[model samples]
Target: MTGEGIKECELIEWHIKEGDVVAEFDRICEVQSDKAAVEITSRYAGTVRRLCHEPGAMVQVGEALLEVEVADEPEEEEDAAAASALGPMPPVQQLAPAEQAVKREQAGLAATLASPAVRRVAREHGVDLASVQGTGPSGRIYKEDVLRLVEAASEEVPGPSLQHKLPEQRAEQLSRPAPSAAGLPAAAEDVIIPLRGYARTMVRSMTAAGAVPHFHYCDELDAGPLLAARALLASDPALGGARLTFLPFVLKALTVALAEFPVLNSSLSADGKALLQHAAHNIGVAMATPTGLVVPNVKAVQGRSVAGVAAELARLQAAAAAGRLGPEDLAGGTLTVSNIGAIGGTYASPLVNPPEVAIVALGRVREVVRPAPGGGFMTASVLAASWGADHRVVDGATLARFSNVWKALLEEPRRLLLHLR
Candidate 1:
């Protein structure tokens, strides 16, 4: 599994179990980080002796995950002779009475039939191996049995420690109504599905976004030229019938504006004493996946032409919807753009993805009546553009100026072509 900046991940499932023979590079388990779920593969061919962690356990990077019993490689004659000269090894110690009893209950082995990994899991959850019934060969306890015990315990009491409650108080707590689901009152027939994986991560990230000193800057852009540009691109044979969208134009314009206002392309240091300016214009495009929302950025957008940006955006959107986005695709974003307009929103104060200073939201393009130079009202296509910036690094005035530049480029779509790489 890829760790990179991830410190720990929840063990989601095990593909290989104890006593199962696995080949090198065979997928052994699935672990989910905040960003994505990844499959962990075996590094050596061997029989799985024990699973170190159970499903739903938070395992840290570099931790031993499982124990494997592999045959030792043959040693050379010189090494064997050197080992023999060192004399015979000492005898193994006998088990204590309590240990002997535990060994008998768990399985009749020289040591506890459970491996160190399984023991670690049992210790973490305070599960007694002597009480659990093992289904493995020779009554060897497995990780699944421990998980089943934990799940059963959780279902008996859904929340809070009732042990300290008085008899009357416990009755009152149990009589209270169950919590709502998805902000709606639960009907008797409603199925309560808990958020997990990407959805859970999104909730945490959005909560952190709320804690940042943030402000919004919104303005309308004349979308007549943008719409024209889209039409022109759609007619070009070079496009190969690929659907051209307003997102590439918006992304390109934002990249150009970022070059002018470099502060918007930087993140604040953790201590808030310094600004970290990124050299590349990696702009994240927010897209909704079936499981949750994901923002996989197009790297180095400052160097890509409109067509290139469009191609990359299409690739990323497809990968994200299919839940196949790689770690790199979801990282290194200096700014983000959320096209809520595609979903029929007029405007939204999109949340800033942390470490980045700003995010821009594009609302749907619609017709608006405005005064013409001749003093007559004329209808023009317009888009509501909203900007959210971390106020710690970007002042209101700086964000306003940046938005003006982005809006201007979109209003005069030809200006964007001049700046394209």
Candidate 2:
């Protein structure tokens, strides 16, 4: 809810449970919305009184997630501020109507009861907790019991293949193969795995993007200067071991072009009446991760040096790989650049990222023979660039001219220094 337009969110996990004492600003929970995974923190010093919702439950904006028993103090105004921070209580909704009932019923069984950690272990090993004999007090299962069950089951199996020996209940769930989202039921052969998490977010974003009118422009540029520029920067001592890639050069060149043609660095107003031109060139770089594609932008790219942009790019990549990207990292992108070249492509008609009016994707560079300025044919390193823009706002001539400006800066990177502050 920190950013606009996100109405619903899925609570990923809680950092503290009931009765846990917490200080102001302590991490409360991690939640995922349409944009990015965000960490909710405590604004009041208190003890966790009750958890209003469970993990994976969807809650709407301005809803009270949990009840906190704030420590009573003489400062009445401070206590009132804390109370204001806590939103009104609202109903929490789950993806499946029967999930809560099923979880409660399972927890009621003492004979098969197991802690979450132990249950997770059993699930990973395909050992049903009902089959593991509880060794703890009151017939409660423990981690050791699950491990023993796994070991004993492995001994009975002739080879490393344990799929055939999975507990009946585990095997049944696997055979059904339906989870996360609504999908078709499974049989012996086919299994329908519904998209969730980033995959789901991507679907929503792309669907929204398609509703807007789009036009594409494609051209190839001689990348001889771009390659040589990267080589020169790679050895710079001031860069301090930052991975010098063509991305930073491309980003810097983009900023130079964006400075002259700021209309491309704009988003359509919600009412579709006014075109909101952003002053800062917060350019997003489309990245591919294990989960899905995420565009985390560098703020104020026009103000940052090529080296500075490279450092931030590296930081974003590492944060994305670790799933630590926050709402700030994903929001406020005015325009985007996708290096499709890294993935072995030379051109792409990418959908313009919603809100932003345009996106540029770079294709793989190749050596080809072309006419030299001296007139004869010569071999040149060329990189393909594709541009997709909101045809409603940006005309073909504007994007073409903008693309030319970008191409000029990237081709002769030395010109980038003129615009450097």
Candidate 3:
């Protein structure tokens, strides 16, 4: 089952079927929804009685996923022990409201009931989550509750400062389906298709990301020295013949910059308080896959050389293309590098994926004429780098300074050796 408003999922593949013996924690099937592609595991050791749904069927969360006839020997006195233990306990009707709030069997939060998405929205609007009543499963605070409070607050705009309403307007616009040619004329046979799986997931995730205040910083780097460096590295047998691209160099330099300015390598805690500066730089690189786009990081790039980064990146790209990336591969992305240049874009304003304070878009290399250091005009290859950062955490000077470090390394490729380790 999926969380955060996902009530059902499309069965992508079933690893087990009718009469297959399953052990506890064994993966039985994989399902995809707007939230993610997850493997459903078995909780009991038993033989499957039935396969309720076929591949590609939509299954509800509350419905019987599959039947299990326990294969383990039963404990005969278990029912009697449970009844005797409960008989000595008072019912909830006899307890006070404060006393009733105690965890019945498991330890958890007292009354906090909001998903990450809901909590993020509430934090943005300065809504007190504790005061908002929850109406979802297990008293989870839904997105509607956060929006209700925001709308009520917007009703009291006393002056003509409409800027206060811009956030809501942008959110409403983003909520609509983005068509490639939205202004084109419609025909009688024009069909409206609903987003599913990866596309649907992108919409929801990006929608939440859109709520964040973002700032973009643009700069151009001379790629002349960088290209020469790549050629030199290509001849090294230590690279293991891994395909070398501009991304590895870009990522390698980014890590060097991050080591100096650790703030950019951090994420806000769940409650939107305190900063978590990660010791390891698990840098995520966006790659296209057979299923969709996946940003699996080259874990601990801070400790790897440029050649190592290339090798690790090759492995991740292969895994993504095969649809074999696990949850660990997809999660824990502290920062991301979107190589829009690979797909032929010259400039991009990439959105900052939440929990990641920053993202840099690498643009296609181009030839440009510039003044030489010795005074004559020189022709050089250049790449444009545009960075988008969460304004709540990153400021212009910090990002610019960080970019300068990255720029120095790329502009003068030999500088990377000093930080290569």
Candidate 4:
């Protein structure tokens, strides 16, 4: 029986007692769905022998939820021959009683031995894992085994080429229950979880953000002077040739502007009654990673100079890219910024990082021509910005003012430099 949508995604839940007797096709468990939970029906009628999961727990799809004792019937000659004719002789040979026991162990090992990446590689390559010899510690079939087999096969066939498949499309070839170094129980099925790390946070944040009426303010800003200033600074030999980004400038302006609009940097209480305001401007920058999303914050952005902000951002970026950031780096953000432009996106309505009232997303800056006073065309870089605000904490007028200030500071790049104290 398959339990649907039990925990996150890829986990199933058993709803019945372990030893409860069940009829064929009877509903025994529920599974997770992309939309909702679905019930799983038993395939065979029998006395319930075992239950693999508890309530509120997650188990992989296709994992045996419960075992059953079925009445045995003597096999007929025709039935045996039909069974033999269905599968290849080698697969059928594995059905022998002793071989069945070995197959169970192999399946268990295959479940545990390979890492997520190794499994993907094996699957894409069409390698039969059971045939590959284990070379990992404790007889585990590691990725090397797959590559070794591929190499051997390539050597055996002398030709212009050996047709091959990617590791993910290939069938699994490894056995089961290869013990990990930490000796935790091995995952026996392919259960995926959507509730891990940033994905988990995104779910919670989206719910909260959606609950509060959100008002967005969008604007296009001219950044000709900002780009010129960046070029001048980058070319200067005294500045150590560190590249300048729009983020530090934006961060500087926003921190200063936050003083005038303090509510935008505040959080709503869990009870949803009181507004929790803080004096510190700990700005969180959203970073996307292969595992999931993580937002690491820079403490006390209010008084930091442009150089100071740049240096701190560089450190945070390195730590995030290397996955070395601690739990503390993720906490205590009063406001947030997400840059979609880096990934080639323009103007996305970003969800507010709760309990913060507002979040900003920076879009790509590109060259655009505007009519000059003398009827000649002039080229300037255009940058798009979107601000998602909690209506409970701030209104449309405030959001527009914030965007206006951000645009003004970036356009007059020298004014931004002069205003930095």
Candidate 5:
């Protein structure tokens, strides 16, 4: 079970069955919440005695999911074996050529027990789970098992025309209309799916945000320098594969600007007479997850370098994608940045997350023709940036100055190097 915010979740699938032995921390099932699929691990070493809910059941938090007959503590040697089995098997590259083939054959023979999440991954990658070996307890197929197979498949070259169809053929096949479901009733008419979990929480949060007295400010920035800086950092091997992106640079610039104009980062008191300025720059990056829109912030961005910010952003993105984010990850955000450009949006007036005075939206970086300083029109990459702030705490003039500072830093990215921690 997760935190109190998530009221209920769907029991997507069970990894262990009644009478199956499970070690402490071994995954027993996977539940789909509004945010993502979560694996429920066993807290006690035991044998599953009863399953309280079947697959697809909407179960409440703190409700009994199942009953386990607790097992006695295991000896050191036995515990070591259990721990070893919990990890994923070695990669295909580690095995001998002949040994790999043998293992693949053995995998085909083994019964495949996969949770719904694992099955979804296999379907998305067009991989057959029946051919994947389960490294989990009772020979269960985990999400990692399917992912490994997908990765290996990607590395292999296409065989011939027989393996892949021509574009014309593919287009023709896809153009065909889907089969009609004339005999079945409409699904919406049959089932009333109430808003719960992530969807429900989003409604509440957005409604609160809407109630705030907010103002919008829009501007455009020359993004050529920011793009070049990202390319340089991404190519540096000394950074150890740390991939730099525009969002991190934006975060860095925002932190610096926040320091100069503390009012833009401050929150208005409930009484509306006082403003509370935060000491830490906990900037939240708005992310669209499979479950819902979640803004998980990296704490204390003012203390981190651009490289460090990139690493933290990567970590938060991965956790959000996997639906493994905890309560702490979703809390304490002082300001937010929404990178709408990743999805092709040109500009947007984003709403400010409540309790936070402001939120910024970064649009796509695209080439625009503009008058050159000393000559005719010139083409340059530009990003459309928009800001939304609580009118009670941040006035239009304050937001403009803050936005200018951010824009200047991005235009002359070299200045960021001087401010790096």
Candidate 6:
């Protein structure tokens, strides 16, 4: 594959070598971004044939990185039919269309030609590259063109491959059992889940959390004051570029409350009979990823300012989004905070993150009017916080007290800041 930006000093790494049979979406290489290394995944299923660029080489976006030899009998059949009907088949050439549309594009023009990645994808899905219209720089065929062509063709042509494969061939591939693990015997039937990035972490965490006895406590908090505080902060010149959300404030408040209620901040021992109270206050933030849920922690959040928290949160969110987090980011979390609000959920009793004493969920905020002390009514953001405590370690009274402290701190954020300092 092509690596455009690689330099003598700058390095890129290719995970899979040429001729390796890789599944679709497998990570094949990694490149360094400004912050960290980012992996590039395979777009199609095939056997790798050649590496167009050497590992650690610089590559451009449209340049061929590598070549894959995929089964293309369906396309071969279509090509033969076209050749017979058209007669003395015209040499493959390019065409400009009225507007950009896949399946109506040109093929001979180098600038309008599809990249190796896109070509492989198109071939697998039986997309006629010539039909797609180029929309890239100087009317070049793009990756998006292949996607659009495939989607449109899918609706028109239902099952082209169903007719190609024999029934016995399909059954043989389906019934064949996968090999057993090293030194282990095969089962009658086994379902194997490949451990990829996010899925891998989910398996580890879920397995660990299952050992603890979890008890959930959920409540709706009046977020009117918190929202008002955010508006006030956003208006300040010093807080410029800082769009205040309930999370950082909640984190600040929770950090202080966690300090007071040390039991909630402590983890249960693996033996299931003791507490492991930590000296430092590390908070894990649950983020939804393309594969699954991943909770990466921000170390010593109690020591950071509102702006500091915001910057770190943005960095972690980006890392989580790009699937670039390391093991350290997923470890040493004293407690977790899950914000399902982004997904429009009002409330969720989040499961306890392993080793941590509790996990708190912040649900969506909604406009609700409550009776005003001096007048008729006032509108405010009604927010919900769902807390899951390890019943073996923390009791209901301790949890109620912890919630009360957090409520007091969030309602009066200035006081929360004082405690943070």
Top-scoring candidate (lDDT): 2
Estimate the TM-score for candidate 3: 0.64
lDDT of 4 by residue, 1-421 (tens): 2122323333345656766877777777755422223466666666665553455444433333444666463333212211210111121221444554476586664324443445555675666676676553234445667778878887887752314544332233233345658967756755334364346667777786787778888888887787777776755554344456878778888887788778877988888789978898999988886546778888888878776777788888877776556555777899999988989877888888778889999999988889988899988788888889988779899889877876787788666665565
Candidate 3 regions exceeding 4 Å error are: 1-8, 16-27, 33-50, 66-196, 269-273, 372-377
Writing each residue's lDDT as its tens digit, candidate 2 over 1-421 gives 3457766666878899999998998888888776777788887787776665678755556555665777775454323222412243232232232554465456774234454445656776777666767753334456678888777877887675545334654466558744666675753743434454577788988898999899899998989998998887797976767899999888888888887898999988888999998999999998887767889999999898888998999999998887678888988999999998998978899888899999998889999998989899999999999999999999999999999999988888899888775
lDDT of 6 at 148: 82
User: What is the C-alpha lDDT profile of model 5 across 83-180, one tens digit per residue?
Assistant: 21113222223344456546656876443455444565566556666678776544556667777876676568554221233444456656967758
Candidate 1 structure quality by residue, lDDT tens digits, 48-164: 776767787666565557766654633322122112101221222345556655767576443344544456666656667776766543455567777687677778978745543
**Candidate 6 lDDT, 79-123, residue by residue in tens:** 322221001222334344444334433434333355555665566
Residue 262 in candidate 2 has what lDDT?
87
Which regions of candidate 4 fall more than 4 Å away from where they truly are?
1-195, 235-242, 418-421
Relative to the unseen true structure, what is the C-alpha lDDT of residue 10 in candidate 6, on a scale of 0 to 100?
15
Sort order, TM-score high to low: 1, 5, 2, 3, 6, 4
User: lDDT of each model, Cα atoms only?
Assistant: 0.76, 0.77, 0.73, 0.66, 0.76, 0.67
Which 10 consecutive positions of candidate 4 have the poorest summed lDDT?
82-91
For candidate 4, give the lDDT: 0.66
Rank by lDDT (best first): 2, 1, 5, 3, 6, 4
Say what the RMSD of model 6 is.
17.4
What does the lDDT come to for candidate 2?
Answer: 0.77
RMSD of each: 8.3, 10.1, 13.4, 18.7, 15.5, 17.4
lDDT of 5: 0.76
User: Of the candidates shown, which would achieve the greatest TM-score relative to the real structure?
Assistant: 1
TM-score of each candidate structure, all chains considered together: 0.73, 0.66, 0.64, 0.55, 0.68, 0.57
